[model samples]
Target: MSVYTQLTDDQFAAFCQSFGVSFARAIPITQGIKNSNWFIQTTDDTDGAPSYVFTLFEERPPADIEKMAVILNQLDGKLPVAAPLAVIESEAARTDNDKRYVIHYEDKAITLVPCLAGAHPEQTTQAMCHEIGAALALLHETLQALQPSEQYGVPLYPWSDVRDRESQFMPSDEAKLMRDIWHAYTQLPLATLPKGLCHLDMFADNTLWNLSLNNSQKGEARLTGLLDFTEVSAEHYVMDIAITINDFCTTWGDAEQGESVNFDRSKMAAFLQGYESKRPLGADEKRALPVMLAKAAVIFWLLRLNVIHYNRTEGRTGDNIMVKNPDLMKRLSAYHWSHVEKAQNTVFVLLNTHSNTDQNNQIVGVFSSITQAEQAREQLIRDQLTPDQLSNHSHFLIKEYTLDQLL
Candidate 1:
């Protein structure tokens, strides 16, 4: 919700006019960090006309923003994404003829999209996590058709910039943790990891959930919208999964100074189950998840620190902006790294074991916790057998094994 440039009513009206949209009013959306967004209300000329979200790209280049629009356009009908609208010259002008979706307003790329329904969940349920996981998998699968290039590929992190600053001010404990994690990260078989389009930031704030009419009775929430694809890029799909899990599965407890991070293994299991339902994670992906989680934590920590440092240097101390606490990420990184071995010990549900043939052993699911594995096994057994057949081969084995063991 950073408004770098302010627009008046007339300016907004003209901007809308250029796109052949009738604008009534624009209300500032004060939630995001990267772009300035406005919830625009329009006259109800059409009975079911959708509300619009106007965005001014603050940091990203116009060319990059254009590419993002193309990506969104590609995902328009397939996913529940707020794809950027095609700009119309006038009432008679055809939007199909024009490839340009963004317009230069005050030298910043500005575009409008139909605001998706539903609200961001404050506390995500296991079902919600499952929905998001499946959605992300679908997003990755859908975006595989695109060719990668420097402009449209993975965005480079300012690791050197952050490292230089960290050397000057980082505490000894935090420094050691970062070094250890970075060292381990470098040793990972990154070249062999599956690469695809990743939403890099699928935190709770960026996701929207809707409660159905029977939601109260069923106690379930449905994922309706996934917002903010500005950080979308081609990267390791597992890394993206780790990034998402770190946000959605981790819970925070209140403390005197800061909150304590606790990775909810059940939620993690549910998310992975949902993800695997769409696209099964490879053995390499499962093994690298802990390191990727730590890497994600470090990346965010560095990013937040850089943001704070730059803001202080630029003398924008009192500005209204969403500033994340780097210390939280710092603590989280240390925690994940320290518990890497434990976190990597996933539960494999062996549903059907062929006679002395290890390769023919049908594994039903991989879960983060033994409890989740047992539950899945129970459900599988229940589905397969009736009350009369329940006495025959209803037993399932839940084995705790590191990802490497499975490989």
Candidate 2:
């Protein structure tokens, strides 16, 4: 949505001609970070004719862009995705071959998607959260129809390149917190978790809503368009849920205001209930929710940092380029951890007997009996813990605790 690559009026007009449209104007959309987007207004002004969203993909290859287009087209009627419009196949355009949805422009991939109706909701309601949750679940289920591909939508998160540079860019405390949350995520039964294509970024701005201004239906908002599938990829269903909840359920506050992160319990309950109506979460997924929520916040915090780093080094600074506040995400990450620590189910504490610090202690599992805790500790050592950390049984200790004792 940001204007990284500025285009001239003549250039835009010619670009629109490929799609057999008389370009009236190309208004740069300054909202997103990954791509150059424009509101394409055609001169046709004909009845039933529609406007389009012209996108210049900053990173994705033409092939990947085409794949995204396929996904959008597949979900066109099923969901309110901004599906890419195929280019008119003139002899000149036919040279690209099979790349109808995406075209090459200065070695960059570009696409034309229908400008969907409805505006991005400024304040999300419980009903909006519920609809989005159901839509997301439906999206995951619908994408399962596609043949699973090893080389599908862009790679999964905590990308090694971004992760490796985190310590270099972020403060030691923030970096350590991010690392700790990620480590906790590694302890989960990820392989056994339900997997499907996920819109890894489902923030409020990414969704369009037909918000009722007047009292037509108790001022309810209905989700219309789901935008920006750049981060859509194969992911765990629970992780997707976590990502969506981190945005839809939480009330984001500006860091300058000194406001703490607030997650709406009622909204979260409504959202989850709506999702379960479509695809019920597994027992393991349910248990992993708290950690996954924290993990989701960590991912976005890292993502914002990466964006800021690239913008600084690459000289992508301007009003047109939107750089999200990484600090807000950082605060959200810390808040989710609080939720994780406060859970009543967090009964079994795994202590590193070799480590002297309180921070080394972790809540490993929730079990009624010491035998169950012992079994979990053994499994954790075998699977998650390093050999050096678990040289012998004396290195680890499991302590049962009540909620009050935890405080």
Candidate 3:
């Protein structure tokens, strides 16, 4: 969308010729926020398929972009990702002997990948959340197995940049809130949390879902693509989970100026359940979820503020295509911190019953309040358990856990 380096028809054709491809057309893709992208139609003489995506990196360095290619290449066939295509050098051409998959065009790293199928979901459903969670778990597990020598090298947060530019913008209430959240984030025990390769930004727009035409179950969608790994990095797994939940499991109220974000517990529960089905979360990760949620909000808020200030200071160019409101994350951070305890305090009630034939354990309910959970347990014991089972306190189990603990 952001055409930092505009290419003419002749230029594109020549570029394709170097890569053993015949170019048909190049249309700008306007949906993305970071790099400049083009939907390219090229004739693949071998297969006749002619869809591809061309990207011109705006901010990332050539080395980092090459690392991204390696990451994507490692993920090919394992996950639904569009990996960068290897460049084919002409036999007569003598250039840098580095076996890289990226091309330096207009002094920026450029890459071409197959255009993946499906579209980003406008509104993510519970089933979609579950599928995305499971897919993310698989991504983490697979990357861990690959054990790439070069770790994901993106910065976790741009705190220094934000701090440097804090005085450029006028101070406001939201600004004060952001400062407080940043201070709190600094105190978190991030080193002890589980670490993995994370898709730091798993927002709905970065994911594509394909729904079956004759689906037997209603509201089911399959994840067809996970795009835009420019923000991928090595970070806490729980922090990645928090970032995703903040986006996918939250609904926003329409506001012309500032949006109101509300977390959906049912959707979150389903997502965690799906995640645990693949890789179970640790106890430390469970206890750190609330703080991680606030941290994720803080990270995005600061990044948005930085983007706004950078564009203003440097003068908006075609490369500066994204400008998100900082107030939205400010409100979200405040909401999550203000209601942290309530969101974390959850309890599960399990009712155990045994017959002469077999033993059965059932999760009767989960409640936010211990009193409600205890009441449900008492009712279940009185109605479903026998006198002998009631005398011995072995049949009913009421366990208290934070929202993350349920994962």
Candidate 4:
């Protein structure tokens, strides 16, 4: 059910009066998705007066709001975040509201956050990527300062887990595949891998840029404000980068011929430089990155598919996690199909080496262009082969499939 909140003129006046502040008007500043958002404006507009963003988590439970607030407060200065400010105090705090200074609006917590100003970016340049990298590095550096966030649900829930979702599709094969993939995911060395703050959903929209300085490059945009810490889940920080790459800088974000998602190696290099400027990644961190990317790809695929497969016309009550992004889904699908080869193709001057176990293996080669990977995978998979077969065999398979057959 869609939550509706109507503050008549009288009610609005009384509410503002309770806070000892008067407002000129309330504008719908929120780009609401699943929840409602509004901006409260005061008539007294000086050069730098404060503004507030009213976020009504209509479907979010009160406990969740409380927990999210606690997490945000802990992450305020530490992470690249804009946390909410509550006026009422919880009974534990021995202050006014006796319930964490939060207002109950339609049974959900209504939070008024200090609105920060920043511009939504269409593209990012190398310098901007560097800033983001730096921000994330800084976040990772401060991870030890805060405790792990409470895990309400399982970290990665495959579609197969839900019987209803399985029944919705043909033969339940998709669900079976998802279940199998989920098992593989859990079996991976997740526990042994590195751990830190992961912004699980730091899409470009979550980041806000200010035009403090403008150069020709998109990645070099000025650092303004990083907003929305609601999806700050715990994991390897690189998981955040993988999600970020898929969302903003990868082919997935590129929709048109000219409107490309710019991935400047120099800019990405700068980002890495900035990240390493703070807490540098260890050998272990680098080795685990591939599996982390794989995890991100799986999550990204399901996130996109859930919206299309499950919630076509109905109001999305389960989550606004995945809205319909054809480009994102397409790229994710492409990545899923090609990641193994793409990983091989991305090898640089670094030599391939293994310490006796599959998990200890590492390959290094020069990164290939997207065109190169596509051409290579086509030739490699002309004749189907399993992972073991592809690994053990020393022969190319394209000569087996005829052009007409392939066609």
Candidate 5:
């Protein structure tokens, strides 16, 4: 959250009072890029008074804010979501026709939600990754059951709108790389993949975790909250998984050569296992994962670039605003593509192979080709799963590899 619209102390207090909480102070939150947010403290000495987060819609309209509020309220206790609090006035004069949560200010909407507990993890653990993965899948299942209208849905990505901006703001090579990745993603059987409303921005900073009390006991951190529903939209379930993995599974390090971003394989496996425990991924989703990972990186890369472009062109500059580095995402995007290429170029060079299928002379050639193809994919499968786990996912892996080859 950034400070685009400054609010006076009186204004903040009045807003809090309308929700029946006496405001103590407003601490500006400068972590995110879109909305203006403050960690609000209340003056009440009551035993159950809770701290809140105040938000001003910097870029979103009132209607969008209202929809977000509705979505959050639906997900409130089931997940650790920051659902908007109903205003006292609205609760008193309740009616089906009137919206209760969003307050329309001059030209924007303001909402107050209870601040959740726990801190953002500085370094991610496999345990943490597992919890968030399961949480994301549950979010998908719950939201899909609601069957939200397309009118409130967001597109997969704004390729047409952002293509020109990418060419203008990025180096030629970087822009071209993005285009290639986008093209690959679009070629997938998107319609056949499972569709649902997804939390597109499930970054590590957007989640809160409670650290284990006994580090020596091998205890896992508990996921306390999932923040920032502003980017939630209807999309393929696999795309959502990719977006979460790009942030959760990659570790950043600085080296003598340059900045390095590498995937933590153990953590990635743990996450996938956790997700599968709730809802197993289909063969199509498995096949689409690689390109989607690259595509997800492109989205954040373009987003960071667009933020810089707007900050300069629109004269929105100050210490209060934070802009992330686009080069980091560029590096991530490149790494994903390189990893995919390495997986694809792996030669089977089988000396001896056995096939379970007994077929006619004509079909022997085709069966032999399929056997060789599976051998080629064996290394890639090992890269993702341990030898022990391979038996469990072999069918899914084969189907995924077959489809990927066809594509």
Candidate 6:
């Protein structure tokens, strides 16, 4: 029924016929904002290669599509990506009874790419983070070697480049905060931030993880598959790492309770540790990362709001690319903001009651609960007390004698 799906089917059949194979079946896989994909099985190739994926573009302008097609064909052997390989060219393409299926938007076209086989990680595990990080580092290295131009298929971030337009979608208070933060972010002096190719929106959905079959004795799980390269572009490469870390650190609602999911700072450390081994980040890049992470979280939260506002009640069929779980979004936004806030506050580990600090110096002496840290700070002010004598000092801080104050 959807034009996107039909066009994809037609394109697949055409590609099969061109390759001299009889297409017996086309199974739909994933259809998104930019493309519709299907798993194509044919009886033509006797070499035992029985499968391929057909991806038809839904929104690429003809010029961009043509440029993208050429770039993908050449870069396929180079990148671990989901870029399509052209089996059938536009010039010799066949027409169909269904006009929409046959006609390319803006005289556009389609291409087929082999689906990289593997399973995706469950948004947990240190191994998965390490792999993703290492792969991203490899990608950055590869892109760094390439010359930039139309062939590179550079991407544009509409919202970040247009925060005034984005603020309209946020809640009033958050919106004000967004404007201030966004302006400050855009105004940042990032003259020397490293730049290269980036999987700008590389989230859990795009990455495929390979798992060990239950009966197989292999102890390792494979996390190799990746998809949806429409957003792949040449840009500030560190944005990709920031996005990956943000996703890796996310925790949703109660459904994930009692699960083996926890953000091991070790994983974050390992990822950056590995990346730095490959390509080092400049001092400015390191400083800008926390801000960029905050920006990523804000963009997703606002975009989720847009999706809920437009799609929830309308009953329209489309891809889940932009779908955001409100609960998860809120949680992720809160977490990212906390990290940024803490980084800004120049405090990493907090000496709260839950921490393993020595009891004598712990915040418990001043505040009754974790929530009381703020109140304790305020109380110290009201009573004009010292930070140490004010209560809420964690056990880690050794106490110097306060007898001088007594005098």
**Model 2 worst lDDT run, 10 consecutive residues:** 368-377
Q: Which segments of model 3 are wrong by more than 4 Å?
A: 44-50, 91-99, 146-152, 167-172, 212-217, 253-258, 317-320, 341-407
Per-residue CA lDDT of model 2 for 50-72, tens digit only, reads 49989999887788887788788
The model with the greater lDDT, 3 or 5, is 5
211-318: candidate 5 lDDT, tens digit per residue? 656651566678889999887788888888988988999886655636667776557666776687689888787777878888889888888888887888889988
Candidate 5 TM-score versus the reference: 0.82
Q: For residues 307-380, could you state the per-residue lDDT of candidate 3 as single tens digits?
A: 77666776776533756777777677887776554544655555554433355656567765443354455556
The residue ranges of model 4 lying beyond 4 angstroms of the native Cα positions read 1-21, 30-32, 46-50, 78-80, 88-101, 151-184, 212-220, 251-268, 307-323, 342-347, 350-407
lDDT of 5 at 332: 89
The 10 consecutive residues of candidate 6 with the worst lDDT sum are 395-404
lDDT of 2 at 401: 69
Model 2 TM-score, 2 decimals: 0.81
Question: Cα lDDT of all candidates, in order?
Answer: 0.76, 0.78, 0.72, 0.52, 0.76, 0.55
Each candidate structure's TM-score, on Cα atoms with residue i matched to residue i, is 0.81, 0.81, 0.78, 0.67, 0.82, 0.69
Instruction: Write the residue-wise lDDT of candidate 1 on 1-407 in tens digits.
Output: 65556789998888877666888888887775567888887875355444888888877777778888877877778778888877765646655656678899666888888888888776767777788889888888888877763446547666767876775677787787888888888889999999877888889888777865587348577777888878787789988898898889887655663587777765776788788889988878876777888899998888888877767776654355667777788888887886664645555555555324466556767777453464465456557766876545444556667766645
Model 4 local distance difference test score = 0.52
Worst 10 residues of 4 by lDDT: 396-405
Give the clashing pairs for model 3.
none
Tell me the number of clashing residue pairs for each predicted model: 1, 0, 0, 16, 1, 14
lDDT of 4 by residue, 172-201 (tens): 654444444455456556666676656676
